[model samples]
Target: MALFHVRMDVHIPHDLDPEVRAQTVAREKAYSQELQRSGKWRELWRIVGQYSNISIFDVESADELHEILQGLPLFPYMDMQVMALTRHPSRID
Candidate 1:
């Protein structure tokens, strides 16, 4: 498995319908939880004072991560930054 760090910032248009926003957000939550339960999504943290989150994912490949991100309900409204992670030699666990 490969590890990745992903930062996602969400931007929902002010003109979007409230009902649609609600449903999309709900779906995004459920999907995120599902991924967590499956162990693909390893960690999640919210950015203070922002509609953004930083998460870690363990997946088969970058393509798999790409597919997973694209499957998010709010994909179109998100700006994401992703980086691959590797253990530091000096770190002891």
Candidate 2:
């Protein structure tokens, strides 16, 4: 499996309907948990002072990661950056 580093910034419009926002957030959390359970999502960290997150994911390929990320309920409201990862040569697992 390949590893990817993903950074996401959420941008919920101020005028979005409250009920819709709540539902979307709920679905997003649920989907995230599903990914976690499947071992595709390795780690997630919320960025301080911002509605942003940095995550590490283990997937077969970039296409697989793209499929997982695009499946998020909040994808429409997120600005995301994805980087493929490789282990450092000096690091021994």
Candidate 3:
């Protein structure tokens, strides 16, 4: 398996009329575990934001990353920008 950095910019409903956010959060957490069990998830994080959240993660590949990013249970409620990534060099040991 190879290592790949995955970054996504995700947008969701802000009003929270019916808690689309809550449901999605639950599903996403479950999905994160699923990916981990599948030996595909390396790391993941969500950044705080006003209307949109940016996420960063490392996975096995672009294809695997895409399938995982689909966010199965809540895919319809949001939009995202996914991209493969590279890490910069470290300053020192």
TM-score of each: 0.98, 0.97, 0.55
> By lDDT, who's the top model here?
1
lDDT of 2 at 60: 94
Q: What overall lDDT goes with each candidate model? A: 0.99, 0.96, 0.62
Candidate 3 structure quality by residue, lDDT tens digits, 1-93? 446554444455677656767877787779878777766775656666544444545566677666766755656665666656654597464
- Screening candidate 2 with a backbone cut-off below 3 angstroms (N, C-alpha, C), the clashing residue pairs are none
Which 10-residue span in candidate 1 carries the lowest summed lDDT? 84-93
Model 3 TM-score, 2 decimals: 0.55
For model 2, state the Cα shift of residue 19 in Å: 0.3
lDDT (tens digit, per residue) of candidate 2 on 39-58: 99999999999999999999
**Candidates in order: C-alpha RMSD to true structure:** 0.6, 0.6, 3.9
Of 1 and 2, the candidate ranking higher by lDDT? 1
Give me the runs in candidate 3 sitting further than 4 Å from their true place.
Answer: 48-61, 72-93
- Candidate 1 local lDDT, 1-93, one digit each (tens): 999999999999999999999999999999999999999999999999999999999999999999999999999999999999999999989
In angstroms, the error of model 1 at 59 is 0.6
